[model samples]
Target: MSNMLSNGISGLNAAQVALSTVSNNIANAGTTGYSRQSVQQVESIAPSNGKYTIGSGVDVVGVQRAYSQYLTGALWSSNSSLQAATTASGLTTTLNSLLSNSGNLQSSLDTFYGGFSSVASSPGSSAARQALLGNASSLATVYNTLGQQLSQQRTQVNSQIGDAVASINTVSQQIATLNGQITVASINGTPNDLLDQRDTLVQQLTGLTGASAVTEGNGSISIYTSAGQTLVSGTQSYALSTKSNPYDPTTTDVVDSAGNDITSQLSGGSLGALINYRDTTLVAAQNQLGQSAVALADSVNQQQAQGLDLNGKQGQAIFSVGSPGVLPSSSNSSGGATVAASVTDVSQLTSSDYVLRYTGAGTGTNGWSLATTGGQSVSLTANADGSLSGAGLTFNTSGTAQVGDSYEIQPTRDAASTLAVSLTDPNGVAAAAALTATATKTNTGTGVAGAVSVTDANNANLLAGAKITFGAGNSYSITDGKGNTTSGTYAAGQPISADGWSLSLSGTPASGDSFSVAANTNGLNDSTNALALAGLADVGILNGGKTSIVQSYANLTTQIGTAGSQANADLTTQTSLYNQALGNQQSLSGVNLNEEAANLVKFQQAYQASAQVISTAQSIFSSLITAIQA
Candidate 1:
């Protein structure tokens, strides 16, 4: 009877606890990050008899939290991928829309180039020249607008990066706090709710920036970034902070708690996406656009310099571009060095930034090394005048450089931002060639001289002009506008050269036949230079002179479009994968109300049955006591 009573009491206790666990599961069924709980049972043993052992009623050992480390890890990985793709996709789309507008660069460029043709039709028309100038101004405005937008995007991205780092730090601190609580709770029993909270925080951390969670022996978790930086370990978490880049303050870099740079190491979440896009894609597009602006302005300015304007003076630059940007490392010694870069060959220029680092005096390679930001080495040539020239730029240093001093030279990154029409007056438009050549009407044998083209606007004898008189053996004598005479041999279809101009003579020229080269004094009727300027629309002027201005813009548009399209596709795939992983994770840990309801019935019945047994034992005890007393 005593053993029966003991068994009944043990069974009732186990059943009550089981019922409580089922009720708890039902109550928290809709809770986020909640895992279903169940009772773990073990048989309570009785002392063995001489001949046989007896069994005891059930004992509730613990409440087990249904969780799987493998499933949860998969979910975190996929979630990180999805977030990164989403961020990149959104930015790429914005860039594509910005550059793909038909009315942006393409339309403005066409209008500007076409204006030259209108001026070529009526060289002396003031209204036509004014319209051409307006077109030029509009072109410059378009370049300025695009450059500003790109720069603004970079600034926006930097701001976002700062926000992400802040978020990661906040979440990390919370997880660390949870870790300390969980480590203590695990000593008594499974800290189910606390573990759920920590895992939730870890997932959020991963979304902002990728992280991996490792379960420690004491029910705590250690978190690491995808780049292997320690984010959280046991009860402690390291904080991340943003700092200005060493060379470019407009750019932001991430640093670890120890003041180490980790900007390049974070490459897995939304934070990584913003940094990568700003540094690589956005800046490259900006540089390419600036390259186009530089090429257009420099080409036009060079041509304008070689011709004569309406006032019969040499043409000045019609466009002005911003100079290259130079930034020295912050760690350099005070007044260490300063570098100014100038574009020397437009065709040889690339859309890349260069880093010029001084390796110390007496070092090989002229004490300095040059490389692109992408890590490709660039060959630098030392000119006789002590200037360094490479990749279409000439770098002149004014101050002494320290051994580790470095300069970031962005050759064309800001050119578009400062592009402007330098020639503001309509009368300043260069409309005529600097000189002209004409054959005398007395020439025989079908000999004729083509139009003369200016070779050097600064030539002292350019306006002096010349007369070429054919002599024996196809030789020619030149009497220049200055009354200076010189002689040279000429062949059919070969040029008769002057001090600043040249003209081709075709067919036979009898001896004593003369052709004259003189300044285009009657400039109003000549449209030679304007026609040449319009022809620039078709001339290859970029990428080693194999791509025209229009084609260069097209390539930039195409690159952005392709990147945007690919980003969207990657985002779609990542979303799908993340969904699948999340489903797998939830299936194992998520609470089911229907299942808990059934458990409620089962445990309730068991409790009642165990109570009946206790009641029976009590009745038997009462009757036995009554019989003994009678």
Candidate 2:
């Protein structure tokens, strides 16, 4: 009977334990990372017949909690991917906005170039030139503004990377601390709510650095990078730092104490995305812009040098000379040269009606005298056959010459060398009785020593049909009377013009050659026109280059998109897996409230019945004692 009562008490205890487990499961169902738990019951054993045993009554076995290692691992993995994708996508969208083709820098360049082209076609119109200049100024402003914006974006990314690293370190430390607490709690068989907190910390760490988690014995977990770098291990966390890349100081990257590219090592995270954008997409765009500038400068200079201007000037440079697109070299001794020319009176020069001449020293045995002492000179002469001599002396041919070099001339042995001259006053009519002069070599040698002089100056005759050729090739040619032909190469003198237009060569023309004329006359020499044209082409070409750069950016963004989608999908799948695992665990561990309540009623009835048995036993014993006493 005592055994029976004891057995009944055990059944009562088991019922209560079941109820507690069910209530606990219901209470924590909504809690994050809380796995539902339940109690297990088993029969107590009683010895019988010395060795054999029989069931006595129910006894509480053990309490189990719901958990699945696989599900938890999946959750951590997905969280990392999700974090990385979000970071990349957000930044790329901003970049795309900045680089968009429509209404962006590219459009600004188009307007600028269009304005220059309009000016080139109408060089005589001041309004057009002014408008072109305005557009050019605006274009420069646009370039500066765009460059600044790009720089700012890079800065922003760098700032974000710093913040992310800090956040990562904080979470890592938290997780490491939690790992210690969880290990102790699990060993003591205490509730592991702190472990759940630690898990949350790990998840947050994954978002920042794409860290993975590994469960250790006794409910402790260690975190590592996807590449297997230890992040958190047994209450110890390694730190991350944001530093400028040694190879490229313009950008920042993640590293440990020792510098290394941990960007690619990070599989998925915001920090990785930011690093990639700065080093690859942003830097390439800047380089492309620089390249476009160079290409524009070079091509325009080449074409402009080949065309003639309004002043009948040929081989004149249109752009500034000597590779204007390159950044100045540090070791260069000479300062950058400036080519400056201005028409004080616009009325005096028209785009189609201007003369360009180099004013410099003359070369040869008897160096020709310059029109102005101590300045460069280009002599102009006329030739017979109605062709002028020395017209070609105005162009540059061999190498680049600076502002103070001279060109010399020698006598030629051809009949075409006789000179003819023509005089034209402001009224724009050729003089009828222009004088012609016969040129004779006073001292002649094989170009090594030659002295030439002009004699028989019938001012009327010489000026009538006499012409001078500046150099070996006729750089300049003037037509003379009815059909008189005369030619003589230029010795030395200022470039004389029938029109009021004059040019100081600053440097010499080649012997027998004229200074190179730049076509598309904007008036400033040294291929300024070519520079303008090249600047226009640069607008188009650079826009194309930028398009390519943006495409690469898009490709990177697309990768982010794919990663983000996959991450989100994984998260969903992980949630499902976790829930299913929890359900299975709950089946073994969770307490059913309704079932527990029913058991409560049954156990109460059993306890009442056992009490009644004890009361009956007591009453029988008391009656027997009384009978014995009587």
Candidate 2: stretches off by over 4 Å: 1-12, 49-61, 101-103, 247-250, 257-261, 289-630
Give the CA lDDT, 0 to 100, for residue 507 in model 2: 33
Q: What does the lDDT come to for candidate 2?
A: 0.47
lDDT tens string, model 1, 422-497? 9988888888887777889988757877878776666888888778888878888999877889988876677777
TM-score on alpha carbons, each prediction: 0.93, 0.54
**Local accuracy by lDDT, each model:** 0.87, 0.47
Compared with the true structure, model 2 gives a TM-score of 0.54
